[model samples]
Target: MSSATHRTAEEIGRTATGPRPVPPLGEQRFAADLSHVDTELSNGLRVLAVRKATVPLVELRVWIPFAGTDVLHPATAEVLAETLLTGTARRDRIAVDTELALIGGDLGAGVDPERLILNGTTLASGLPTMLDVLGDVFTGASYADAEVARERERLIERIAVSRTQPRTIAREALQKQRYGDHPAVREVPRAEDVAVVEPEQVRALHTASVLPRGSVLVIVGDIDPETIIGDLEKALGGWASDATAARLPALPELSGGNVLLVPRSGAVQSQLRLSAQTVPRTHPRYAAVQMANLVFGGYFSSRLVENIREDKGYTYSAHSGFEFTDQNAVVNIDADTANDATAAALLETRYELGRLGMVPPTAEEVESVRQYAIGSLVTATSSQTGLAGQLTALAATGLGPEWLAEHPARLAEVTAEEVAQAALDYFAPKRFSGVVVGDAELLAPKLTALGDVTVGAPAE
Candidate 1:
């Protein structure tokens, strides 16, 4: 090798002896001009329009609150969502697909305990056609017996397969442990119930719960906000309802105590799911709480992952996050570990939770996660689809675009002291209730030795 090249290589190696200081993150180069039109129609359906001329495409999201007290609501709603776009009064199944294809549009619907959502995308010029199709499905769905039967069978098969998953078992067990027999625990309905859901019942559910009165439609992309609302009025004016939108029963506050065990016979690994009651996004301390969570387990660099995965090699991945409903919110932590490492991983998890409260995060730790949080928020909403989905979900909880605009500032202003306080309040080990799902023979002793163990059937 030449002397100059060798010397240059040696200099680069010498420069790497100590850790390089990361450049400070610059101020946000662009404050999102989240200007939009938000309004309510005469029939009470709310419309939100955001204009982003980056691409000549439009994204649509519809949220209809469908909470019900009936145990069968979830099953019936699942079938309804699956078959919603299959056929309408004026268009048969094939015709519907063909028509949407002609306009370069596609749409789908899904259901959960709280809402039925319709999400779609189309060319910018096809917005009116998409809205018209949406109106057709909303007002004139046929819920044909053939389509319902097909979708229902498919849903049953999917649910049966999903039930065999460790994560699903753990989640259902945790919900039941937290909420008892509350209907809110029915995130996934019984497979048997879905099999028996008749077409007439699905149509009835569509008639009863799919109301425009309290629903929201979010449209984003290259479009004029003023012009789109008018188009929506012309398209969806026929879909009206006088009945009030259904509301879920208040979510019981999450309380932490003994751990529950769900026996998954002969399982190779355990899925540990933990949750703690938390405040809604509107809470003043939410920003601090979010940052504290990030430092605890919200990211790959979090203390929980650093201890249990990076340091100990317990599991492939672990995560902590928040789930928000209309007026309730909770923090969820999940990790899947080998049967042999389950106890050790759980012990480390508990240690990190406790340490975050008692020892608190150092300024460096807090600042690292704070930057991640701020950067994540900006990147998450920088896309049209991301912003549209976010805005629609927020609307269901009575929040709007203003909340999105102000949240970055709130996160930026959170202090290290405040994050520490939030950690102390919410990250106490005793404040988490969860379920460990694994083989009974392999995990029973280790889990029982860890804490209390309850052997019970997972909620149907």
Candidate 2:
């Protein structure tokens, strides 16, 4: 072809009718009617098994409430999660790995102040073997002395590095500022604490905290929900418990006040973390709040991003989203800004927040957010792993697949008036309080000049 005959890329994208008419989005679809079983095994572990035959694979998620008030609980829990799959009575560390590998499976565990989570995947046909391994770990894991020692040392080193991270510093300050002495504030255990955690303590903590009565297991894959329940019963039959898992103490309701400015002596950048209490997923008003959140700062095109990130260039990223814990929920807004832009970033963030409620989202804004919300939900649950994750989270709060299936309709039904009302009720500037972490000398003057900001560190 001659060079002259080759059309440019832009010309190829255009037509005689001018720019092509963008095709309208197809009708939004809700989640399929999943074949599922939501029932409690005799041992008291709630089992939620759903059949989504998208592929010949299975995804598993287990959630167990693991809160504690013991001073060394966090460190012990951390070590326990690392060593949980190291060995059971019937299998040692290498043996456990070999068995899982034979079945194309792998399992891992992690713990936080709120819960201990174990998630994994395997070939669908290997579900029975996977259940067997989980059962062994739950019922009879021997937190071997060597394994405990190794992981504890590694955890101590990791904690040392983590505590120095800006995000970690900001998070700890924010938690303390918000929750005071609540155990939930103790997210990262102290390095000193991990150093002193013994194998005996890890074993004791596992025996007491890793129970079944109040925990939930979610499995999604290409299997029969009805028969899978029987398989689970057979596999985890002996892993019984009379006591429920420990639940974290309820957090005090948050009321907006001052934003604490925590000094990080030489930091060149600042992390602005703001939070406000809000309704949980099961709340009737959550759909409206969800849309309101997207319009404010939940997505790339939100008002906050448009103002501080795109226009003013104060931040490269700014985000707002909800964090759910058991039955409680709160919205968190965060941005990392250069030291010079820190105070201005906070000011613009609050400005957008106030604007969201006062001006509210227009019909077009409402529709855009609504579509985004529904589309995100659908995309998130389209696969087995995604569905399993969604179910595990919902099951922790006593919900099931039915709730997931109906959420799209709920979002679609949310009106512009409702979203605006949610904005006013939830996104008011006065309804938020948080921490700004940076050099006190650099940020103190401008941040203090802005009212409702206090200088100094959060209380220990």
Candidate 3:
């Protein structure tokens, strides 16, 4: 190397230190101006529009309370979502796709037990076309027999393939254990039912429940909120029905008792799934509990990950998160380990759960997690699509951009004492009950001794 370049490199390396202390965050709060328009149509359809001039595009989200408690509803609703936009009376499937492509737009719909979610995106100028297309589908979906038949066969094939997947198996088993005899347990419809679902059944389901009344629509883009809401009213004026939207009954609380072992014969790895009842998002203690969750297992540096993955090298990954559906909220924790290491991994996980509650977080730990929480929230809503999705979720719980803008303060205001109490009440290991899906012969021996052990097929 030249002498001059060598000397420059040496000078740069001299300043690279062993450790650099991170400066404390200044006493400045980051606030977002999330001004938006919220209105309801005469038919009870709610609309939330936010003007964001950052991009020449628009994101659309539609959420309908599509709950049905009957045994056939899950399979039928799945079929309905798959074919919702295949064709309308005014346009065929090919025509719909062609128009959307011409406008640089795309749309998709899916169903869970609690909601039917329709998500779409389009160029800013195509907002009218997007709404028109949505209106056509909402009011005039043909539910053609040929399309339904094809999608039904495809869905059956997909279900058959997914049933054997390890994650799907674990999730199904855990849901059943958590909500016995509840509709939530029927997330995946029975394969036999899917195979037999007729187009008539799907058409009937749509006619009965897929109405605009009691539904929510969130639009975010580089557009005028006032003009857009007016446009939405005009576009969806005809998309009305007398039938009220379907809604789920009050969800039963999760009952925690013993660990249920679901036998996946000859499996080399086991999935550890745990769940406990938690309060809904609107609960007064939710912010503190949310912080406590992060310190425990909600983030990479959480105690659960530090103990089970980083320290002991049991599992490669682990996570804990909340699932909110209407009035229900559930805390779900998941980790996967080798069949032989299953029991040990679970033991360490439970230990960390108990430790987080009993000992609580240190002041430094609370500050670190609180900063992480606030930062994550800011990052989540910084983009148009991100903000639209967050607002859409909040809309379901009777919240809007006001709540979105105010949640950062909520996280910041969570005290260390509140976080500790939340941990003690909610993060205790005994409050969680779940299923361990692994080889019965291998796991049953140790898991039987670990807690209550029951052996059965993946479905049982």
Q: Which candidate has the highest TM-score of all?
A: 2
* lDDT of candidates 1 onward, in order: 0.86, 0.91, 0.87
Better of 1 and 2 by TM-score: 2
lDDT of candidate 3 over 319-436, digit per residue (tens): 9999888878989899999987899988888898989888989898898889888788777887888888888888888888887677778988999999999999998888988999
Residue runs of model 1 more than 4 Å from their true location after superposition: 1-17, 29-32, 457-460
**What is candidate 2's lDDT per residue for 114-169, written digit by digit as tens?**
99999999998787899999999999999999999998888988998998889998
Best by lDDT: 2
Q: List the candidates' TM-scores in order.
A: 0.95, 0.96, 0.94
Stretches of candidate 2 exceeding 4 Å from the true structure:
1-25, 28-32, 458-460
Ranking by lDDT: 2, 3, 1
Per residue, candidate 1 scores C-alpha lDDT tens digits across 134-222 of 88998999999999999999999999999877777788888888888877788888899998899999989988989999888888899
Which is the better candidate, 2 or 3, if ranked by TM-score?
2
Show where candidate 3 strays beyond 4 Å: 1-18, 23-32, 456-460
User: What's the candidate order when arranged by decreasing TM-score?
Assistant: 2, 1, 3
Q: What clash count does candidate 2 reach?
A: 0
